[model samples]
Target chain A: DTAVSQTPKYLVTQMGNDKSIKCEQNLGHDTMYWYKQDSKKFLKIMFSYNNKELIINETVPNRFSPKSPDKAHLNLHINSLELGDSAVYFCASSQRNIREAKNIQYFGAGTRLSVL
Target chain B: TQLLEQSPQFLSIQEGENLTVYCNSSSVFSSLQWYRQEPGEGPVLLVTVVTGGEVKKLKRLTFQFGDARKDSSLHITAAQPGDTGLYLCASPGYSSASKIIFGSGTRLSIRP
Candidate 1:
């Protein structure tokens, strides 16, 4: 069984278009996170959800929204996409205290989004 | 978000060579994690160091935590082609911080 999974491993859309990336975790973790890695290979945290409650929202653009229907899933929606939005989006999950000391995150295969 | 600086943004070495990558930050973190990402794939956790000055080893890989808990290093012994990938360092923000700041990643390539 996959601990974490993301749909549409690759997405290509034109500018001003809207798209969504879906993520799900079967590890029964209480926390889920969305991160974006750009062409520069820099991984940045975009949002975090704890038990379906919004916890951390970085300086991400308003056009990017993360919706958690339940603890098992967290989806990302991008409206009026821009060319700069092209990047690899990754989904991760972890328990409240996933580790004894360091909370380790389990990541799913990333979804590469490309905007023209 | 805390900013992390990783050194030697890109590295290339021959088989059996040894190399080390450093991750530094001004902010203190209770723990720091190391992840390896392959092409077109998500990162996979390699190790996590919680206690300051702690050291851990996995196979030929060695990890060390700074005494101040503000930095860390990853050392690979006898590098191999299989080790080619992106290495990222991330710290689960301060206690109850809610977010993690990941270092810019170091790309390593080993020639067979």
Candidate 2:
């Protein structure tokens, strides 16, 4: 589709449960990122991967882990989730990370996660 | 960590009205970008300002980068109902792109 795509557009689970959200990009970009949008609609960066290598890891909790198997795919895995984890999680990607270029990011439709 | 403070967290205006959203920061950025996000969707990039004091226009929307590269603004002229959405600003600093920071966002509602 030449866009960033994410699966499980909605998720509902209990506390202490584990879940995973998958992401893929057909834009041929090398860098992928995961962002969490809170209830306030604030988008915050969680993790970033470049060419299947982990690059940026924000001050996120250890329970939220992001794994990249290939350049086009990045997955988010959460262990022992809490109620505060409920939010809309988005996946994005970009071409280059160069300072001069500062490549623009393309985002997915987002996965709304709800924990009870 | 760099922080982007967006002004006027919420705004409601009638159609054809004008308003501006501001993003301010204490740290300099290599490039700043503006995005508009609708309900249930991810943010869509509107513009990217690379140079300090640079100005870019997209239709009725205009974006300006601060001369210090630490702030930015998005002004809309004759706004329409379709302009209602959450506007976010992001600043990805340096070559690593690790220090990227996003503004709190401006939620604008344009009534027709």
- lDDT on C-alpha atoms for all candidate structures: 0.91, 0.90
Sliding window of 10 residues with minimal summed lDDT for model 1 chain B: B92-101
Q: Compared with the true structure, what per-residue lDDT tens digits does model 1 show for residues A1-116? A: 98999988999999999999999999989999999998999998899999999988989999999999999999999999999999999999988664435577889889999999
**Against the true structure, what is each candidate's TM-score?**
0.95, 0.94
Candidate 1: residue B71 lDDT (0-100)? 96
Q: What is the interface RMSD of each candidate, in Å?
A: 2.2, 2.0
Give the clashing residue pairs of candidate 2, or none: none
lDDT (tens digit, per residue) of candidate 2 on B1-112:
4288998999999999999999998988778989999988889989889899999999999999999999999999999999999999987656666445679999999999
Q: Model 1, B20-85: lDDT tens per residue? A: 999998988788999999997899999989999999999999999999999999999999999999
Q: Pick the candidate with the highest lDDT.
A: 1
Model 2, stretches more than 4 Å misplaced?
A: none
